[model samples]
Target chain A: MGEFELIRQYFMPLARLHGSSSVIVGPGDDCAVQRVPPGSDLVFSIDTLVEGVHFPVGYRPDYLGWRTLAVAASDLAAMGAEPSCFTLALTLPEADELWLRDFSLGLGNAAESFGLTLAGGDTTRGPLTLSVQVHGVVEQGGAIRRSGARAGDLVVVSGSLGDAGAALDYLPAQEDLDADDSAAADKQFVLERYHHPQPRLDLGKALRQFATAAIDVSDGLLADLNHILEASNVGASIELARIPVSPALVRLKGSAATDYALHSGDDYELCATISEASWVGAPAWLKQQLTVVGEIEPVSGLRLDGSAVVSGSEATGFDHFRRKA
Target chain B: MGEFELIRQYFMPLARLHGSSSVIVGPGDDCAVQRVPPGSDLVFSIDTLVEGVHFPVGYRPDYLGWRTLAVAASDLAAMGAEPSCFTLALTLPEADELWLRDFSLGLGNAAESFGLTLAGGDTTRGPLTLSVQVHGVVEQGGAIRRSGARAGDLVVVSGSLGDAGAALDYLPAQEDLDADDSAAADKQFVLERYHHPQPRLDLGKALRQFATAAIDVSDGLLADLNHILEASNVGASIELARIPVSPALVRLKGSAATDYALHSGDDYELCATISEASWVGAPAWLKQQLTVVGEIEPVSGLRLDGSAVVSGSEATGFDHFRRKA
Candidate 1:
């Protein structure tokens, strides 16, 4: 199929699934025209995933599609914005019909799950890469920011922390896990967590009412949480025992499980800070997703169990061009 | 330098150059948040350029950066939307500080020229690729779209056509042309057109007042005009003698000058359908940019000089995957 044919056959169908009321002109135009609800702010973000560096070459197309869209959507969640639509800029080495079909199916599933629609996009021939830009709407003055955290705010996180990180550490051992029947389920669980991270959109929306600051845990809990601290000009003291680690992660890497929770990245869960009063007043369901792990302080340094956090490969999370070489 | 340092030094300055009032939160965040002016619609588009496939493998980084932003911005112009802000998703093989500095300078220059700012973006290590997503705003019902073309409307284009296309065709001859001093200035003009074709922003905005339909001539005049025809379910009769050809383009292609005007892509000029009454009322400065070339017809085929348009290798504009084997 040609680029136009591919877009028509695969992408165009995805656009038709949800007829968004806000979109004046959707796909098949030079630009997708959408209306931002009056009294609302437009929230937008772009993320690119490249072959080899971001994901292994020849990775499953469906998973790759889901991951690219999900990761970009996570940024909207961090801002407490309701997703409106997204545009994709895809680069592929060639046009493969079967691969394109599966990828679009996965992309459609993501759009459906997130309550957003495919607006418009560009497709080009090149090395395998995907860039997704998401647009969302937030009520005026309701959007969350990393710079809103106060010195005495309580830092919290949603769900488990290290499963995705642990999955990355043990991905190479998947082939051998099948031989050991006992490890199969855990291996599948961890791998799925890594491949399909659930962005905390609902939790973030709830946080808009109570949280002082917010960020998505993309580059490990420590690294992402530190972003909130640095932006807000404060410090944090994380309780060593409070970081949530899933059973699958602990089973996969036993004694070093907490290390992954602290430093390993790709956890799309959210990290936020709230006042003590808001934490106490938060509804039960909302509280269940959040676990208090630390408290913000006046000084500017990260600490664990009252000691400065200074030792570990995972301490700083992954940096693209500056990763240890 | 680390990704953070690189952004602080290069990207952050671009964001600070012109403080955009619509931007609620700009850069240094999970997502950039901005407000769409009340009673306006948000218009957005994304475009990706890959090394080798989109341009030469070792193309000038500064020109590459400018071209990437300018081409994406052209989509906004086609929609008759005012440029607001843009995000960059850049993938690179390595962190070459010098290359990054020049590229960011070009990107910053484009942002300043278009009156937009760097909102937010992602950077990673991989094969060289740049994906830019531009945001614009237009009155709720003011966006010019391809589907709005009507029969009897005059097909008009802004500025000269095919300069960029001719430049691409004659680029290899540039080195040889330098030996012939007479061709030097034209060579430079054509090369600049190829590398940094201006987006007709003012023309597009003006088109909202009089154009029934509009599209940027990214893919040759004939091919892009066909898009408006197909979308609006109309045909066109293009006057061969009326097509505007620049002196440099005519000088370079000689006998094939008309062919390039008819079929060359990437001119980045505005091709729009305007009612005759609106054309007559248009201001002289705006009228100077527009040249009448054809008329929309009730039939369902494109023609030139009373004959069907066929028998040309460059008949269709470029398609990503279908251009060539």
Candidate 2:
């Protein structure tokens, strides 16, 4: 099929969506249209996913498509902006028809799931890399930034942390697993978490109402939340015991892949702060959907139940520069 | 260096630009804010450059940085939109401080050169890939889209064509070229064409006031303009003698690689159409800046000096998917 038809068929149907009203024009032109609310601000974020580094070396096209968009969307989720349009820049070694078909299906599904439209993007020659720049809107000066956390705020999380990291560890890349160990048994949870972690848009919008500070846990809770703490000049105390460790997580706890839980990263869940006073009035859904794992304090350094964590020591999160080729 | 600090140090300064009145928020959030002019629309486009695909394997980081953003800005120019804000999604194998320092310098240089601000972006682990999403504003629905050309429109181009593709043929992908080859000596032109293309934003704005259709010479003069003819359902006739060929390009004609210049692609200049009646009255700068390349006709297909130009046949321009990995 022709390039124009291919995009129209697979991506256009994904436009005219929830984040579309402000987008006066969506795709099919030199550019897409998005109107800033009369007095509101615009928030922008971009994310890139390389095939082998960001995902399993042999991951399927479908999951690659979903994970790519999901990761970028989560950035918009971190800021309290209404998810709008996104541009996708895809580079691939070659255009395998089957891979394109499956990838488009997964991309279409995720786009439908998030109510986001494909605005525009470029398809180019290169190692497979997916880059998405997400656009969202915040009412005039209403965005919750990393700098807004106060000393006495409660650090909250939307959903359990480290599920994606667990999923990654649980996925086959765990070479340390006994050669004879049965991977089939652990594949389901890991696959779901790895492939389709939702971009909490609804929860993100909710956070604008309750969150004073927020960030998406892309580089692990400790590292990403540390961003907020640093931006706000505050420290955080996590009840290592209370940081929601799911039953799925318990399976990995014995694995010291606890590093996976502690910092293997890529959860894409929101980590936020609300004043201890405001936490009292947080919506019932906020409590049900998000876990209160820590509290913001006036001190400087991360701690687990009052003990120093990573104090003048090595970090336990993704290191873009340190990874071995 | 800390990831957050590195970003704040190099990136925050780029966003310090005071953009158009439509920019409610410039950068530093999840997205950017742009005011759609009363009756105007938001024009969007994205472009990606991969380490080895768009450039040589060991191409300079600084030039890549500048070129990446400049090429994407050309899309806005193609639509007759004023340059606005842009978001970057930079994927690198490693974040070497020196590499990033030069990269940011080039990025900052381009932002300043183009009067755009770097708003927000994602940095992730991957084979090197750079994605830029540029947003521009067209006067309330005045964008000159590819589908707007019609029979009897005067086809035009903003600058001399083929220099880029010709330059590409002679560009040294490895070490410096030998002075013995005349074509190789032309590497300077090709490198400039490839690494430092002008986005034509001013010419684009002028065309919006005088043209009926527009497109960037990304694919090739013949092929890209064909996209306009095909989309507008009109044919075009060109005086082959009138097709603008730069000094460097004239030397390369008649060689097999001439086809590459005619069809090799990656020149991000503007090719547009003006109605025959509006053609003579076109704004002064547009008349000064662009050349009449051809004229549109009631029939379908393209002609050069009354002979049909071979299009949609063999290789016309760069096709990411069709290329060998």
Candidate 3:
């Protein structure tokens, strides 16, 4: 199919089903026009995922589509903004009808899940790469920034970490797992975490009233938290035992689970700093999903269990260029 | 350099220099936050350019930087929106410092020239590709849509066409042109048109109150105008001799200039349909940049000098997938 046919067959339905009323003009135009509600600030972010570099080559199209949008939407979650709309610029080697259908299905499902409208996009021929730019809105002056962490703030994270990182080990043999086998369930759990990690949008919205600083833990906990420290001119001391990990991760990696939680990336969980009083007063349901793993300090470095860890050093998370070379 | 350091050394300065006051938070944040003024609608579009596909391999990075942003921003212009801010997602095989510096310099110059602020972005490792998503603002309910053209509306286009497309013939030997040669200056002119095609922002803004519909000519005048016709459910009759062609293009292609003017892409000029009264009353400066090429009709297909030209059949413009393979 041609680019226009592909868009009409696969993406137009997705847009019609999940498109928001705020979208004045959706897909079939030079640009998508949207109405940002009064008293709101617009939040914008762009992320690119390339085959082999960001994901395994020939990865499942549905999962790839879901993961791509989920990854980009995490930035909006980090800013405590409500899900709004997104544009996708896709470069593919060919126009495979089946791939487009499955990918659009996955993307549409995720859009429905996140309440994001499909605004506009471009499709071109090239080596496979997907660039998604997400737009969201928060009440004016209500955005949480990385530069707001104060000394004595509690460093917190949503849900559990490390499962997605640990899942990398089983990815190559993922298709080999038998559904009826005893260990298959745990493997499937981690695989799901890797392929469909949910953005902590709800947790972030709750933290808007309480959190001092926030970031999504895409580059592992240590590295992403250090960003907040550097931006806010503060330090952090993380208790190694307090870091949370899933049962599936522990079952797969055993003693290495803690290491994964500390240094591996792509969890998509929100890492935030909040004052003790605010954390204590936060809703019971909100506190149930969070774990206080560290505390901000006056000094300007990162520490684990009272031992200093240099920023951007050995324990720092994924750097696309450095890690590759 | 690693991705973070690369961003800091190159892109951060661009953000600081062209950063808009509306941008509450710029680069380094998970998502850039910006305040939209009350009573305005947001307009968005995304475009991707891939090395060896969209442009030749080893293309100049500075021109690539400027062209990428300009191509995306043309959508905003077509929507008659004021320039605002944009996010870039860049994928490269390696981190070349000199390329980054020159590319950022060119990008910064374009940002300053177009009144766009650098917001946030992502850098990843892959085959070289750049995706730009631009955001602009228009008065509430003021965006001109492609579906609004009336049967009597005059088909108008801004500036000349086909110089950029014809420039491709001289691209491989672009560096061989000597200043003292007689034909060198004309070759250089078309090359410049190819490298730095301006988005008709001023003309588009003025078109808001007068135009019934508008689109930017990225995929040949016939193909793009066909889009407006299809959306508006109307037909058009063009005067073959009235199509505009640049002097530089005419000098190079002579008798073939009209074909390039009608069917070439990447000129990035605005095409709109307006009532005859509005066309007559338009400001002289605006009128000077535009030419009356045709008129919309109640029929359902395009015609050239009363001869039928089937839409999406023979005269259709560039299709990335279809044209490639």
Top TM-score model: 3
Query: lDDT, candidate 3, residue B115?
Result: 84
For B1-325, candidate 1 gives per-residue lDDT tens digits of 5777777788888787666457778898999988899899899999998887667677778888788899999999999999998999999898788998999988888888887888899998888989999989999988999988888999999888888877875565644666557767776788788888799998899889999999998878887988898899988999988999889877777878888887776678999999888888989988899899999998877898999865222346578776531
Note the residue pairs that clash in candidate 3.
none
Q: Specify the poorest-scoring 10-residue window by lDDT in model 1 chain B.
A: B309-318
True contacts kept of 2: 0.71
Cα lDDT tens digits for candidate 3, A252-317? 788888999987667799999999999889899988989999999999899999999977633485
RMSD of each: 2.2, 3.5, 1.6
Q: Evaluate model 1: give its TM-score.
A: 0.96
Q: Which candidate number would show the highest DockQ if scored against the true structure?
A: 3
Question: Mind giving the per-residue lDDT tens digits that candidate 2 earns over A1-325?
Answer: 6555455666666675564366666676667766666666667777777766777776788877788788877877877777767778878776566777788888877877766677777878777788887777777678778889988889888776666776764567543445565554454555577678888888888888888988887778777777787778888898876776556666645555445656745667888999887789877867898888888889987888788777321364456655532
Q: Please, what are the lDDT tens digits per residue for candidate 3 over residues B244-295?
A: 9877778888889988878877779999999999988988988898999999
Q: Looking at model 2, give its docking quality level.
A: medium
TM-score of 2: 0.90
True contacts kept of 3: 0.90
lDDT of 1 by residue, A72-155 (tens): 999999999999889999999888999998999888888888877888999998889899999888999789999998888899
Model 1 CA deviation exceeding 4 Å by range:
A172-179, A310-315, A322-325, B170-179, B310-315
**What order do you get sorting by TM-score, best first?**
3, 1, 2
Per-model TM against the reference:
0.96, 0.90, 0.98
